[model samples]
Target: MMPPTSSAPHSAGSAGALLTDARLGKKPAPRLRRYYLEPGLRKELPKLHQILAVDLAHVVMLAERGIIPATQAARLVDALRDLRADPEARLRIEPERGSMVLQIEAHLTNAVGESDAGALSTGRSRIDQGATVRRLYERNGTLAVLDRLVALQDALLALAARHSRTLMPGYTHLQPSQPWVFGHYLLGFANKIHRAFVRMLEAYHHLNLSPLGTVGGSGSPWPLDRRRTAALLGFAGLVENARLGRDIQYLADIAAAACLIMNEINDLATDLQLWSSNEFALVELDAGYCGTSSIFPQKKNPIALEGIRTAAAQSMHWFSNVLALCRGMGSGDLAMRSPGHVDAVFETTADMTDLMTGIIETLIVHPSRMGARAQLGWTTASSLADLLVHQGTLSYRQAHHAVGAFVRHCVENDVAVTDATAGLFASVTGLDMALTDAEFRSALDPATFIAACTSQGGAAPEQVDALLRAAAADREADRSWLDTEQHRLASCNAELDRAAEILAAARPAGSHHHPDLAHE
Candidate 1:
């Protein structure tokens, strides 16, 4: 539906009139329904429960405030509950009607007649109700994504814990650069994803505020207790500005967080995709996550990672679209504020995270292969440079140049890193190799390089263990947030159900005493 035309509620039997008098005297064109109204209805199907919850809470609040008679409120509440109970049977989007409230009115008219059903929007407009529903629905999407992210992080942390000392070649500009620990790499992802999780959770707090009572960007004539509806709907607080309540920046924040999440997923998935390839063979996806190429007999493709990358790229496009649509919109710019498929992006993001978590949990690592590759790339050259600075009485830059020259000499002479000697190093760099044979070999050892990296956030086993503990704590905190929010929302829903049932039962006529009314 749309905003109410005036402060007054529409007449009883003329259902859908609230959206009708948009200064357009005629009904929406049939073409409009096909292009716009039809798809909007299908989108609302997933949001049907949220729509009813908002209406139920509003009607109960009206009853609690004595705005409508107790008997009428009882019927209205019961009718809404009925619609909620069997929505598939009771609700349908008529092309001509083109409004959820209208459908509700038709069903309510059947149950309680139109006169009482007309009071359903007593102190509110459909616009405010829609804003409220959007918030609730998006809250659910946010939590769904967060739940998956937490599980993904937990899986990453578990893998990191097991492979604390596993060695690999770290890359710079896609070229092998240094010795790296797999556990440290995974922890980096854990930390990165947690940042986006924080952004989403923060946005959720702003998103949780109630916009229900901000009817048409202004308060209505009735003494509508906004707080009562907020409580029933599980809002943390009111969206204090009635106008600003209609739209908020949290939608963009959520979109941005989703983009960041997908971007992180893209990077990780790209790495996994590469690692699982025939050339790298550092890791392999489980058979369940792989797909056999129909045309190629021997190919077991890393299809899950490919799917994640595809979804993530789409999310970036959606993120850019959200920004494009949201820019230059006013506070009440309903047309563009809820512009596009932010919800779809959220669904896709959560799905990909779930997919990644499965991939990580069932992954098969080839440590021997990873270590063999790590040792072959002269990845320990930097460690030798550090040793030169310490023992060769050379400056750090001088040492870097010397090591660079040695690497070039080894490449030109077809000599492996293990074949380097003091005479060979001296011949290459024209400098004395102050480090003895044992010291030089230790410096070139990939394991020794990683072990010596004792700085915080380093590849050293102890450092990685510290990061693993931090990651565990971070994950625990994230889990606590998810659990607490789920419980809060669940308990609020139960209370709403209980209150609706309480108000729906038969009550004494002309006796407005309801248990939900605040104590004087």
Candidate 2:
């Protein structure tokens, strides 16, 4: 008793139909739509709205230049406003109807008249629109990740400030080689993060160029004001060459920036994972960020640190995928506009930033354990060698040999460095290195060794304090930059809204051009 299901192919009876049928099909398979097309459209809807806002600005400019009729532009702007107000309208997009843009056009035609809705696409192509959307997305994503990086830097500086005198062993090839304050170790990572911020800013500069007027990878036929559109959309300038505007190089640049950030996160996670182990016990994470073994109640695992490492590794994989997708593809290839590839790059980068920020903000440090470990493996051996070279009559090479022999002697006798004596020193160097007991003990003390490293950028407390101050200043500058960027974007949106309002007012009251104008 059920009616027969309609299997008729979708008819190419309109502009939307023509574009959709050419790229997809009259009727795409359900699995393809569910797996690729529908998901792509859903993800692209927000970006579609953003690009449409810019397109409305373009239409306004065209109207001011007498390229489009004033009444038609007003009606188109009204339809755009209607679309903006209704979030559900974006979800109404069907795969058989074409891309999100085409569907939006179809919606506009239904809301406004066909003539005015069609006029909106007069001087533009999907190529330019797609490029501009991606640039905007990347620009916003870069600023967001940069904000997180600054916060992480702030957290690190705070921890470093608190631990300026907290002694820890500096390692070389997994072996304790020298004594340094934990603050100095933290400052090293902070500097690397600052560099990552700089690199992201460079990439942001490149991606800020507007591509809205580079129609179809060549140029628009109409006399369009590219700079005007750029200013209206808060872009720095135009991409200039149409072909280059369509290039995927900017995406690759973003990927590279992401790779830098993830690499730093990986390094930090590696350190935290090692330090939190039972053998090291140098730091303990907060219970909120850790987990216990399902079968063993005694296990407190640093699960968040492990997750950060995994996320960082996944970011590298996403970067590789983006690079491979763009490797040899010529400029303006449709494949370069793949939504899944682009989304993976942006989403993974943002996720990694958030993960790292959470990890840095909540973890706890144990200074006593760090100090205890700082004294092991003869961490002050280099200081002792330097003391022999300077305070005793020995060549530098002779001093090194003496320190090597001394370490071997300690190993053989199983004696701690703290228990070393003048007799032991004389036996190793084969000379009566004259020094009082206090002086000999001072040379082997980790705290004394750290204090004696008064060179610039050393582990000395004063140097660590100076580095913390520098990091604070750097964080302030980055905060100022972020504020400026956010204000610019906000101002652009306000300007666009004002422009739309002025255009909408120009239409005659109760005009038959668009009925929704009154309600809007």
Candidate 3:
């Protein structure tokens, strides 16, 4: 009775064309009838259609199975498979008479036809269509983000290598604690990024499931191969339950991934902002990533780092918003119907990815400055403590306490730790007449201290070497995954191009041609 789930989504021919024209008042851009078909919107479309394609194929299979008639199934199948650019590239429509008034469309052509209603809405409602679109977005966006993360990892690796021998003062409690290789310090940040990457990759798997066939709040009665569709889109599989698929639970994975990425970015940005300041000046960022100051002409502001910091704050807020959106709502459709959740999450993610990629591309090293900073402040004081511990005059715990006392005395007396350490050691042990120059120099040489740290995960060059090698292998694995994704996207583009060519050929010679599908 409910219009028999009409075979076609819209009316056919000139009427269908007018249906596109009907929404012209809403979108002043004079573009596609569906906003999603606009250049900007189309750019956001996901590649997981390889999954949607499968779902649609199953719909065709349903028709083939005689669950639906041959003509209707063929039309639906054709609509699904067709990749023509929406003629109404950013068109939206509002029908005054119907409950289904909020419909929008994109690049409607032969498949959409002259019908006022087409197969796009035949067996499914906009609720289901929106869900499918969202799934495609999440799946593809996750893949893209992972790729960008890999690039960032590569950039950090190169930076670490470039500054391997560069020295820097390691800090604790806002005071210099020890001397370490610049590479070792850079690798510290890299380790954080690596862990974040791993968390995101695991989150991606959670986001990669298909939600396409979960029609409306439930699912279609017709037989559908959700698994086949997921495989097509490269998703792990469908969300097993229909109601759960449409619930806010599905979107939470994306939110978690966004939070992890922004958290990592925030930490790194804060560290860079602090280190790049006049007070620290341990590293000099490239001019390309900086900005001019209006009030202060000499200011070479680290705008990139600042922007990342700001973006991270916004992204964290987005994660909260997403979680809040899912928190109190009822089951079925009411649980998470907010449009902003998907849109904001996507925007924040896209912004973060672009910003991070740019930072990686333009980042520079100032190893000499870093090393010089490390050389000051009996930064080697810790090594002297280790020396005492090694000589059996004191245990590590006792040495730690003695070092603290020595540091306090030096600070109060306004003398360097070396000056105080000899007297303090002699006072404590009543044995040392005078610590040798060789001993003092060995403790002071940041390099020797670093090399002496031979334990696992120590700042010793060898320990850092092991970490660096492991990071390299991890980076290589990330690159390999990126290569696979790149190949997949390439194939999508090729298919899209082929579809465009086919459309161009099918059109009447005098008909206006659509622009070619292209990437930025």
Candidate 4:
């Protein structure tokens, strides 16, 4: 299925046409309304209804405060509830109405007189409405991204647990540098994703503030209770600075968090792509995640991973677009409120996170091939140097030089480090000391190399196990955060529903008019 569109309500062609016709003294071109304007409204209608609900709650608050007459507020609330209850039957926007708000106002004016219907927008503007909707959209989107990230982290931790001692070749500059287990490698990704999750939560905290009371980048003339509206909307607090409430800098925070996530996915994809190649032959993707080439029957392409890589790149482009759109725009400019651009970034980043999670969860590892490759690259040379240092036979630098020379001699003589003789090491180190067969084997053993790395954040099995346990705890914390935010949003929506119901009940039944409004 296609992802959701922006939360900003589109301008209705009818509203635009009526205004333009009044100013120009002629019917506006039908093509613009039919092709450009109408289609946009139709696409945005679903999310626009959500913004309408928020507006209704604001109107109810106005009534309670005596800012608008209680009778008028009841009529407006009833109409709003009727429209919201059966949006397909009651909410309509023709080329004569310009927006969802205008459409609603027109309906209410026709249903309960112009004075009562018009009062619904007493302390609100399309500008602040748009900003508020975007925040709601972002708040929802951030939670979604976090949910996927938490799942991805869990998947990684599970995979890492099973492969704690599954030795693999760790690389530097695309060349094998040392021996490490698959578990340790996966833990690295888990740690990175954990950091991304934390950053997203930070961004979520910032975006959850309400901009409802800051109508048109300034406080409304009426004494609107910003805090009450914010509480009703599930926002943590007001944006405080009315002017700053409309700024698009929050989009930058979102973009930064998304970029961090996609970049991590890109790195993981690169590694998987390399490992799945014939040259590496270290991993086998599940058939569910792979595709066969149309022209080559033997080809089992990692198409899913390739798509993830491409999605990561696309997210970067979308992030750049958001940055550019908000770069020079004023706080309340239309450019600062480009919901479509910002939504694209969120959608793409979330897509990649889900895709990568699937890849990690299902991909098959080749432990034998990984171990064989790990042993082929003289990956234990550093271990030998360490052994030399620990034995008090030579300083670290001297041991490093000795091991370097010994590796070159083995390479030149077509001898594997595991098969080299004691005489060979002595010749290279220019020492008269004798080395035992057990010592030679231990020095070249991948398992020995991995076990010896017992530093705080090392590849040793014990260290990896510790890291894995810590990551599980971190994942639990992230899940708890997601749950808390979800409950907050749901409770806010429930509160709004209750408030609307109360206002609607104040009016007598059947007092409002019903029209066969088109669902535009």
Over 1-520, each residue of candidate 1 has an lDDT whose tens digit, in order, gives 4212222234544343645657776767869877876667666667788989998998888988899987888878876776688776556445455656666665566566657767897888877887888898888899999999999998999999888889988888878899888889999999998887898898788889998888888777889899988988989999988876667567778888888898998999999999888988999999999999879999999999999999887787765676666565655465422555877977998999999999999999998898999988789998888887877489999999989988988988899988888778887788886667777787899998888889888888889988999889998999998998789888999999998888877555554322210011
Task: Assess candidate 4 and give its TM-score to the true structure.
Answer: 0.91
In model 1, the worst 10-residue window by lDDT is 511-520
Please state the error at residue 504 of candidate 2 in Å. 0.8
In order of appearance, the predictions have TM-scores of: 0.92, 0.92, 0.77, 0.91
Candidates 2 and 3: which is better by lDDT? 2
- On a 0 to 100 scale, what is the lDDT of residue 126 in model 2? 75
Q: Which candidate is the best by lDDT?
A: 1
Worst 10 residues of 3 by lDDT: 511-520
RMSD of each: 5.5, 3.9, 7.5, 4.0
The per-candidate count of clashes, in order, stands at 0, 0, 35, 6
Model 2 ranges off by over 4 Å: 1-36, 89-91, 512-520
- Model 4: lDDT equals 0.78
Output the better candidate (1/3) by lDDT: 1
- Candidate 2 residue-wise lDDT at 338: 61
lDDT for position 141 in model 2: 74
Candidate 1 stretches greater than 4 Å from native: 1-25, 331-333, 506-520
Candidate 4 C-alpha lDDT tens digits along 216-260: 776888989888888888899889998876777777788899988
